[model samples]
Structures are given as structure tokens and as C-alpha cells.
Target: NEVFDNLAMFAGYGFNKSHSAAYGMVTYQTAYLKAHHPVHMMAALMTNDADRTERVVRLINETKGMGIEVRPPDVNASSLDFTVAEGAIRFGLGAVKGVGHSAIEGILQARKDGPFLNLYDFCERVDLQKVNKRVVETLVKCGAFDSLADGPLPAGDLEALGHWRGRVDAAVATAFSLGQKKQADRDAGQGSLFDVADGLEAGPVSYPEASPWSDQVLLDAEKQCLGFYVSGHPLDRYEEELGVYATHTTETLERAAEREAVKIGGVVAELKERRSKRNDSRNAFLTFEDRAGQCEVLVFGARYAEFEDLLKKGEPLLVQGSVRIEGDEEPRERKIICDKVQLLLDAREELVNKVTVQLEADSLDEATVCELRDIFKKHQGDCATYLRLRVTLAGQAHFKLPVEYSVRPTDDLLQAVERLFGRGSVSLG
Candidate 1:
């Protein structure tokens, strides 16, 4: 009995020592690889966790923090797994939702002859039976064919065929129709006169004109197909406002003091509502994402009721909350208890007091000043305007405009000013 008890104890405790040693060695090796080969390691890590969208997003952010760029999926460039391209990590086609292994294989086999020249060329060459319309549309929506769309075209062709998602989508349908006809003829052993005549060719390709998608629309499409934003985040436009108004970022909230009051700004990445177990009160949890990272915000009882309308996915919100850290663990569970919330745009309008336009002395011609005056008049409001003129050797001069010249510093006005003066010319205070 004593011997059996001793053996059982050893089996339970002594075996753990060997297991711990093995784990320790593996941990050390992984840490070493991450420290030295961060890009390669992160690429592998991302590929391994590609099925987990949330984990992939976290890894992508970590890769960026390590000074490694994670490029979007490209049908012409990416393989089935994440690949290293010019010191950056290229996302894999296999990671994209709705693109199956067979579809990727078909795309790869078709591209072996050469890189796809355009959407038409891509559709014509690839086996449409495998790389179907839905697969092609999903790839295009997620920016897999962005390189092809953005590539230089023959002289006047680009202006006539203006490359936008809507145009690309229309072109895809036309290309598929032509491809199907050609395939049908070939299968039937019938040849057209143009096929027999080497000198003859098809006419120029034309795309239907469409208004370009807004940044929000593009991001939404990316999220739909890729499970996350690859090209850009929706909150990117509110960067300046977030910087000025937000007291904490999702990343910085980890170190927030217990029950500390804070203001955070981000788009609602996710929202889940439920009834509280104790009181049967409606409560909700929001996964908020900014440029830095993501955090959870808990809205309970009256707070959920007050902010229910604002807790919508993809909507930018400036949240006033207090941190709630549970336990004293190394990586404790942290969440924000929502106190109040408001639209990010509304917060920006209420907070921004001044707008400054920086101009080079040589660029300040009569035409430029007249355009600036017209812009101010077009957006007339209460925000003060100032012009900083940069002169060679004499230093810059700041001139505040009269109260009548003050204008509303809305996104449209800012965009107009940027379009006229170029980026980095305008600042808000």
C-alpha cells in the first residue's frame, strides 16, 4: 500500500518537472526566434492563426509595432500562406473568407503562365468553374486585385475606364460573359473568323462609370471578406480628433488605475446585448477598436438604455467610462464600465476651437488667397482661422483672420482646404 501511494504521488508530481523543463525550453526557443526573426515569426504565427480573426488582428498589430508591415492579400502576389515580400508580410489568399483551397489552387495554376494583366485577363485565364464569380467578387472586394486595378493602363484607357470597385465589378461580369462564350466555342470545336485571322483583335475594353466608394464602404467590404480591415480602418479619418479628445487608447487602458475615469474614442467593432442575471436588466458589451487596438466596454442597466442607439457596429463613438480591473493576476481581465457616450463628430465640433493653415510665401499668390477666402466664405461659422506664412530666411508669420472670416471646421471644409493646399497644410486646435 505504501509503495503504491508513493508511486502515485511521484506520477502526479515528479512527471510535471520533466514536462515543465520541456515547455521551458520550447518557450525559450520561441522567445529567441521572436526576438531575432520577428517578421518571419510573426508571418508564421499569423498564418497559423489565420482562421481566428481576432487573434490574426492582434498579431498584425503586434507585427506593425515591431516595425514590420503587413500588406493586404494580392491574388498575383500572395501564396496560400503568409509570405515575406520585400521585408513585409503579405497576407495569404487562404486567409480570405469564401476563397476555398481549390479556388486558390485554380488561381495559382492560371497565374503560372504570367501575372494577371487586368480583371478581364484574370477571369479569361483562370478556370471560372473553380474561380467562380462569387470568389472573384470577394477577392476584389477584399483588395486582392487592387494591384491590378491600380496598375498603369495603355495611355488614355485609364481615364476612360476609371478604376473603382463598382467599375471593376461591372468589368468582371462582362469579362466572365466573354470568357464563357469563348469557352463554349472552344468546347464545341467552333472557331470565330477573328480566331482564324491572326491580325484581327477584339475592341478596347470599356468600364461603366461609377462614383468611387467612400472610405467607410471600402472598409466594410474588407471586413466582410477578409474578417478585418486590411486597407484601412474607418476611424482613420477621425485620427486628429481622437488624439485631441481621447484620454486613453485601447492599448493604454491595460495600465489604467482601478475605477479610474477615462475618455476613449473608437469605432464599435462588435456589440452583444443580454439581460443581467441578477436584475433581469438589459446590458451590453462592446468591442471597441481604435488605431492602437481593441478593448471591451460594458454597459449595464440605465447606461445601456442611454447608449443603446449609439452602440452600433462600425459607428465612431467617444465613450466616457471608468476602468474595472478584476483580480491581481499578471494579465488581469480589464473592462470599461460605460458612463456616457457621444458621436465622435459631435465631440469634435464642440471641442475644436481654431483652424490653422500653413502656407509657403511663394505659393501665396492672389489666386490662392482668393480661393482661401472663397473656402472660408463657403464654410462660414464660429471657429477661428489663422494663416502661417513661411518665408525664406525671415521665419514664419501668423495672421489671425477677422471674426467674419471664421469658418466651421467640418470634414468637408478640411478636405477642401487639403485638396487646395496639399496635405499637412491644415491643423486644428
Candidate 2:
């Protein structure tokens, strides 16, 4: 308590020149090491955060991004903390959610005599009580046991792969019984002490596939290691369509808002509702994005009334309006708000951000609207804007104003428009 009181000391003052110089030197050294040897740097990061599971996962991704191949945590090779060997980083057993240091240490100690040849060999050597099926399964899912397993099980065979997990415990129990029998043999002096080496069971089974999964699928599996999706984002599937309506990627959107009007698109990541200071009914926030990136949408009750339909998460919308730099009155510079969403389509977002449908000047007939419906249906993001084109058929001048009006701004709508109209006709604005 006395030491704690002295250490508190109401925080501190600025650093001296020597302190600054030393700090600068360390910072420069770290930066240089990171720039030149990112894998090693990330391995060190993983080790430092051994007790912090979440950060350890992040560092693992960072290592992979640097092209450092991570050796899965193996019964034969891993330690409690992440280690680097021969320019490769090993997964840290301590990074797994349930397996703590003591449990990991127990497994590592078992490996000291020799490497685990297979699931059976590991079962014979390691203590199951310290490390259970749940712990082992987590390692397998994260690809930590991949080296020992040889290769991953077949695609979609993940659940069936549970068989190998049970093998470890069964093999260990069998090895214990053999050791007891050997003890009896030794006491009788009837057996040769130095004999032929024993063999291990086959590695975890491999499955048939023409090729490994696509990068997108592999990256998704990697996300199970890290809490958040790291490699390619979910929006990567429809980059062309998302870019049509989205003003900018979330990361880029944070930087500027010069344009008076902009269209930004994103998958609806999340939505939340809140009450204003005055307890007014309408206050909400939304986070979504396209492959380029993502952005947030904020709406107050008054604003929400008009844009309520667009506020939903995962909705592909080309929102047009002003970008106001909020909190600019004070010292802090903040985001520009996207005000008034004109069109939020229910369907997939396409390359065309907006749709312009042409109608004959004189025809309000059902046939004309029916034709418009058929044409608009082809669009992705289901977005459409109707425009009447008046031209002479030589007999009658036909004109039609929209009696009922709507469009689904979807990704297909954009692509369909590109096919029907010229590429430039369906612009985001």
C-alpha cells in the first residue's frame, strides 16, 4: 500500500533530453527491425502478449501478412510462448483461449524426450488431464497441429475429424499399460534392453480435393484464429458493385469530405439505436462497407424519418447529401456526416449506383409501367430512377408520369444497367 501510494504521485512531468534521446533510439531500433524483419518482430510481439490472448492472435495475423509461415503448435515442438526457429514462427500454445501456461508447459515437457510422431504417439506421451479434448480441438481448428497432422482434413469434413481428437487419450492409456509390462520384463532380466525402435500411428487423416480452397475461404478460416477477419474482408466478393455507390472506403472516408454529395456502399455490419439528450425517440448509428472499405451512418430522429429505410445494416445504399465536418468548432477534427440517403436498395448492389428508366411522354398505361418493372427487375441493388423520354412515333405524342414509383438498388441492378445502358449512364451521383 505504501509503495503504491508513492508510485501514484499524481502522475508525472515531461521527460528530460537524455530520456527523450534514449526513447528515440529505442523507437528507431524497433522500427528498423520491424521494417527489415517483420516476421521476427511479430513473433516477439506474440511472445510479449502471451498472457493477452487477443493481441497474440493479432500478431499472428501480422506475421502471416509479412509472409512468415507459422508452424502450428505441435506436441513435439511448441513452448508456452511463441518461438522462432530457422526463420519460422511457431504458434504459442498459451494463445489458445482455454489452455493456460501451466497446461502448455506440461505438454512441452512431455515433448522433451522426442517429437510426437502422430496422434497416437502424442496420446502415449502427454498428460490428458492437463490438456483435454477441448484444448486439443482449439489447436486443431487454428491449424496449430497442422505439422503433426501432415495436412488438414477434407473441406467440409471438419466435424468428422473429431475422431482424431479422441485417439490421443486412447493411445496414451495404451502406452502406460505397455510401460508397466516392460517394467515386469526388466525385473525378470528376460528381455533385451536395447531393441528395435517402435513406430508411431499415422498422422491425422488427409482428404481428397482437386485443389486447396480459394484464398477467400482460407482467409475466413484464419479469422477463427484472430477474433476479427484480417486477410480479405467479407465485401471482397463484390468490389465493383460496392465502389459504384460508396463514397469511399471506411479508412479513406475518415480522411476527407470535400464533395458536396457522395455515394458510399457497404455490407451492414451493425446497427444500434439510442436516445438523444432530450430523450427524443430517434437516434441511431450504422456501420457498413464495400470491399474498398466501410463507413458509419448516423441519424437523429428528424433525419431518421426520411432515411429510416436506409439506416439498416447490410443495406446497399447510394446516399446523396452533404458531408459536414462535425466537432470542427473545437480543436478536434472529426468525421463528415452522410446526410439524406436518396436510394437504399433491398437487392445486391451492382456497378450502377443509380438507375434511370425511360418512359414515353404520353403513356401512363399499365403496359408502360409493366415494361419499366421488367427492365428494373434486371438491375442489381435493384436501384432505378425513372426519366421520361419524349419522342415522336409519328402518330401520337405519348407522355407518362410515374403513378407508383420505387426501385431496388442492388448489385445486380448496376451490372444489368451496364449491360443495357452504357457504363456511364448509371453513375453513383
lDDT of candidate model 1 versus the reference: 0.82
Question: How far is 384's C-alpha from truth in model 2 (Å)?
Answer: 17
Per-residue C-alpha lDDT of model 2 across residues 1-429, encoded as one tens digit per residue: 988776565334334656889999999999999999877788888878877755665566557667787765555667777788888987667765667666687678778867776554554456665666665555544545545644465533322233433333234444445544554565688556342234333334333222334333444444455333433454543454555545665556656654445556554545678877786677767655444434566666777777776665333455544455666554333233556664334323334434454434555577655655675644323333655364666543323324334355544554455444334344342
Give the distance in Å from residue 178's predicted Cα in candidate 2 to where it truly belongs.
17
Q: Tens-digit lDDT track for model 1 on 263-367? A: 998888888889989999999888888888888999999998887887764567899989999877778877899999998867878999989999899988899
TM-score for candidate 2, please give it.
0.50
Worst 10 residues of 2 by lDDT: 156-165
- Give all candidates' CA lDDT scores: 0.82, 0.55
lDDT score, candidate 2, position 52: 72
Please tell me which predicted candidate would have the highest TM-score against the true structure. 1
